[model samples]
Target: MLKTFRISAILEGISYLLLFSFSMPLKYWANITEPNIYIGYVHGFLFIAYIILAVFFAVDKKIAPKKGIMLVLASLLPFGTFYMDRHYLKPLSAS
Candidate 1:
């Protein structure tokens, strides 16, 4: 369970980075207007998967519903998932 969370967390982190980097060029760079459609699609899928994985982990581990929902929301905020992993998940794994 912990291993699954770790891998999902990493993938979620990378997906967030890709989304931010891609969005910058998409909005600001007029010269380089073309966006990587494939990357966008991949990140979208990964984002969904990451949320599903988080829910599964939370339910299996009996995490409170509110906390589980917060964890999912963290994925949407910049670097929030990293903070969640460090503070919320690390100690769970340690035990």
Candidate 2:
């Protein structure tokens, strides 16, 4: 389950970056909205999956309340999931 969350984190992070770096630019600057459309759908799915998995993992592992809050907060920021994966998830898996 933790492994799954780790994978989800990575994917979610990448999608978020792509949305910011590629999709949004194309849509706003180039007036091309297709990429954002598809990427948005993907990012939306991954975002939801990340949240659900993070919640389940936190509950299953009995994560500290603060850390669990961090996990949710991480989902909101760019590159946040990558940071969370490195600092939070990896240590748990290593155990």
Q: Say which candidate scores most in TM-score.
A: 2
Candidate 2 residue runs with Cα over 4 Å from true position: none
Worst 10 residues of 1 by lDDT: 30-39
- For model 1, the superposed segments whose C-alpha errors exceed 4 Å read 26-28, 31-35
Per lDDT, the best of the predicted structures is 2
Give me the displacement of residue 25 in model 1, in angstroms: 1.5
> Against the hidden reference, what TM-scores do the models get?
0.83, 0.97
| Candidate 1 per-residue lDDT over residues 1-95, each given as its tens digit | 87778778777887778767775477566545345566677778878988889989988989899999988998888887888888988888888
User: Per-model C-alpha lDDT, please?
Assistant: 0.80, 0.95
**Candidate 1, lDDT over the whole model:** 0.80
lDDT of 2 by residue, 1-95 (tens): 99999999999999999999999999999999999999999999999999999899899999898988999999999999999999988998888
